[model samples]
Target chain A: MRVTVVGLGPGAGRDLTGRAREALEQAELIIGYTAYIELIREEFSHKEMRSTGMRKEVDRCRAAVEEAVAGKDVAMVCSGDSGIYGMAALVYEVAQEYPPIEIEVVPGITAACGGAAVLGAPLTHDFAVVSLSDLLTPWEKIERRLICAAQADFVLCLYNPASHSRPDHLRRACDILLAAGKAPDTVCGFVQNIGREGECAVLTTLAALRDTKVDMFTTVFIGSGQTRVLNGKMVTPRGYLQREN
Target chain B: MRVTVVGLGPGAGRDLTGRAREALEQAELIIGYTAYIELIREEFSHKEMRSTGMRKEVDRCRAAVEEAVAGKDVAMVCSGDSGIYGMAALVYEVAQEYPPIEIEVVPGITAACGGAAVLGAPLTHDFAVVSLSDLLTPWEKIERRLICAAQADFVLCLYNPASHSRPDHLRRACDILLAAGKAPDTVCGFVQNIGREGECAVLTTLAALRDTKVDMFTTVFIGSGQTRVLNGKMVTPRGYLQREN
Candidate 1:
């Protein structure tokens, strides 16, 4: 018996990797956050499911290990790439507490990458990725990190930017970036529900982003000095050699 | 008769997305660089292929458009995400030069995302992405961006850091980063042949990366100040909110 930890990607169905599909198909018991379970509900209607809401990740991971130890193939699903702020670490954490279980991690399309792809190519070079949530870390630390990333002229990809109760964080982040010398016209992109039914992309300037409506599901990309808006697509060239014969 | 530009991912078949797979199957004429064509030779054996060596991307893109205009479903395959320093932009460039042709881009796993996933996680926050290649852009500008991103503490992902002809660029970039006050112990990761046969991930520090062997196939990630090495994996935490009990 083994446990395959799979990433379901940013949204439902469309972003499931081939390996994730295979793992899900082979799983006798599937465990994940409720939202993730609902996202892939169609594929596992017949399989035994153990779904929990957020903050119950630790318990869910333990259950998957328990099921695997009981001789059942189990898969714990996470949104986006499993290793990036997903269930892979949590699973490993719990597995260390319990018995050792054979674990396989299947990566998926992360929101940052998916958002960058939709925006043309804003992630062409050295960049920084940060989340605005202050659950484990203090907001002051997150702000300091954001300031550092912005001053570096890095194309920044921000995850978990805002939620219902914390809507002001994104706005504050935008303010800090502006203060850090990021130009108002800096190309900024916001993608919502990527690879899902309402998947949409908007290419705007940093100034415009502050006033834009963004929800928890949105992943934002703030382009650097090198980033440009060409034909409505935001692009940052990686300087690959072009032949000039 | 439309052209569907597809990203074949970092190396070969394993990295191709489901949509990319479908696009290849429907393509009557597949056009790409020889390496990309060889990567998926088995999948497109029956299709007419126009393979070119490096630096011939513009030519290949032009040929693909012409073939598509002649009522053929043509696919222009690019390694990594189609929009990120891939052939999608070139296809659009050539298509503009010719008649207006319908084009759809099918994205695949970019090397940055794939490499980051393999290293556990180093892209969970606001970061900057820059390239070291100065073929299309000047090295002075690349250096400036690197210095800026480093000062900002943005996690940096470098594409095309080194090749057979130009190997010192990555070392120089590291020097610029260090001069900007980035610590020597800053977690840096290198992934070669991601999602392909010779896949290898090395977790090291910035100072060590300067001496490491890197090539065109490698995707390098220099972690932000917050990034750390845990259990042999490079991880960047995306702050998550915890509900009050």
Candidate 2:
């Protein structure tokens, strides 16, 4: 029996990759966060499912591995790319204690990439992705990363920007970038519920994003020094064709 | 009539997202670099194709927009995520000069994300992606980003690592990172021809990767201080469950 860790992309079924879709279809058991399971349930109702709430990642991974070891094809689903703040690492870490099983990780369109498409090309150049959620990582560490990335002029892609308990994390992150010399007028944008219901994108500035209310479902893109607004879309040039000779 | 900038997702057809496939099927004209055009020719042969050689990005984008303006459903193909070092920005930039046309950028699996999965979750934390090619970006700026990212302890994903004209860029970038105080034994890996023919992943240390030969098709991952080799996979913990209390 084999285990495939699949990234469900951002939201919509069409956003899911053919490879990932095939993996989920072939799985006898599919496990994921409750919200993610509900997202796929309508399309894959026939597959056996084990759904858990948030913060139960370790237990969820263990469940998938046990099912795989029991001779059932299993797929552990996660939103966005499984390897990026998703379940890929946890699955690998937990599978260490389980019986030998063939494990494969199928990549998906991460929020950074998916949200960037909706906002034009905000990540055309070198960029950094830092999740603002402090659930697992220390706040100090997250702050340090935000400051360093901003100082380095790396376009920042902030994931897990806000939650019920972490309402102020995104604002604090923006302040750190501003303190690191990012201009207040620097172009920035965010997309809420990308590729799903309530999908919307707002083009704003660094200062505005700091003040705007956002939620956990949003992916914020803070542009670098070179980012600009073109016809209401944010874009960061790759620095190749536009360079002065 | 619209322009859909499609990301082919690494190199495999199955890796292509359903959304991208639909865009290609609806495209009356498909245009891209010669290599990328040939890569998808078998599946998309029915569409009229316009292929060009390297460094003709502006010309290729102009051709796509022109076709779209002429009432043709156009799809401009890019190798990875169109927004990340791909043609999304160029498409938007060029489309500005033509007649108003509805433009949509389809996201795909960028090389860094796709290659990371093949090598096992090397991008599980805060990370930065910098292309080593000096074609559009000045070498001095590239070096600065490499040094800054290294100093910040951010895992570095090097794209376009080597080309015929700049064979020494990867080695020099590694030197800068090593000089920035990164440990010599840091876990580093590279995937060549990701999702395509001749796909291969090499796991090594930072010091060893410095002396190794690479090509333009390779995506090199320099692990952060938190990264490790679990079993045979390069894994970087996200610091959630593995954090010190």
Candidate 3:
């Protein structure tokens, strides 16, 4: 039996792709982090579900593989696009250790896109994405990349901004951005659990972002010089022509 | 009646969000360019549809506004995210002139995220997105941004890389990138009609990218040094700890 890994795509049930829906429908067992399973829980009623809490990704993925090896058509769910810091890689790694388990990845809308969409496409131009989590990489490298991206005027999307232990990284990143010539007026937006029931977006300037409440569930966007607040919405133009007469 | 502008979210049918699906299901007149209309044609058998050709965006959007003014629930469809170079801006522009029409925007998954998913999250770190389309903005600005992003080593995603009238832009972009110290072996990816039936992804280097045939339908990602090709798949390391055994 084959296993399917599906990205729930942001938070909305409809954001799931047709392929992902079919995979979930056909799966005898659904396994993932609690939040991912909750996001698409309504889509499947008959499937057996296994969910783990935060920081238990490895465990959850391993369990999914175990279920798959037992001849169950299983699906591992991830929020947004599964490959973008999702379960796709972990599953692949685990599969390598457990032979004979066939798998396929069904793509979904990532948080970066979800946040960018709410902010009026600040990423329409060249940009960089950096997660603030230094669990693996040194904070020095993350800082250096932040400086480089800021100086280049890249539209930056940050994930894993703040957890219980890392409350200062986002603040530190803002400080670095300020030192790199990104103006205090640069548009900064944060979207939390985009497309979910409590999903919300905040639009502010870089100087004011420090006062904003951010958490591990938030995705932040730092806009370029061209970013502006238009009628309460943050927008970065994509340079489309109007055929001026 | 209000006009709910829905985004199809990439090319897949399931990428449509719950809000977008509900809006479409409730709409009496569905209006969009041909490609977007074709995406949800099966869901609109009983609804009235007005599909326009390319370059007729303004006209189609105006018609949608007119329909809304006539007290019809209209769904104006856009591919990818509605706000990013989609019909959202045009709808707003026309709505200002036709005050009777009210509008709401529904977001979607953009091509950047779709390409990033296939390329193993080159966007995971800091990145920049720039459009090579000079139809509205001058090429000088686009060139400067490219140079800046390349020098900063920001993973870069380029939209509107080439079209029938501007085939050399992608090649010129590669030249500018080379001048900025990006290595020739730097992993670069090109995806065309991402998530669509004819989707094609090519993983190559910066130097070889200049020789590739790219069209407007393509989104090209030039990865940072952190990006690498793994078993024929392009992957940008997010520095997430694999497992410390």
All candidates: DockQ: 0.39, 0.74, 0.41
Tens digits of per-residue lDDT for model 2 on A138-181? 78878888877887788999999999998998889889898989
Q: C-alpha displacement of A62 in model 3, angstroms?
A: 4.0
Residue-pair clash count for candidate 1:
20
Give a tens-digit lDDT track for model 3, residues B161-180. Answer: 99999989999999999988
Q: 1 or 2, which is superior by TM-score?
A: 2
Query: Where is model 3 chain A poorest over a 10-residue stretch in terms of lDDT?
Result: A236-245
Window of ten residues with lowest summed lDDT in model 2 chain A: A236-245
How high is the CA lDDT of each candidate model?
A: 0.78, 0.89, 0.77
Where is the poorest 10-residue window by lDDT in model 3 chain B? B236-245
Model 3: fnat (fraction of native contacts)? 0.36
TM-score of every candidate's chain A: 0.93, 0.97, 0.92
Give the interface RMSD of candidate 1. Answer: 3.6
Worst lDDT window (10 residues) for model 2 chain B? B236-245
> What's each prediction's TM-score?
0.88, 0.98, 0.88
lDDT of 1 by residue, B1-245 (tens): 78887877776565666777888888888888888889889866888888999987667878898988888899888887776677765665556567667787777777777787677667655566677887777788778778867766777889889988789999999998999899999999999988888899999999999888788988899988878776677877543312222
* Per-candidate iRMSD: 3.6, 1.3, 3.3
**lDDT by residue for model 2 over B156-188, one digit each (tens)?**
899999999989888898899999899999999
Candidate 3 lDDT, A1-245, residue by residue in tens: 66677877887376766667778888988988887788767767667888899878777777888888888898888888777677776665556567578777777777877776665555554566778888866788788878877766767889899988988888899999998899998998999878777788889889998667698889999987877665565666553324533
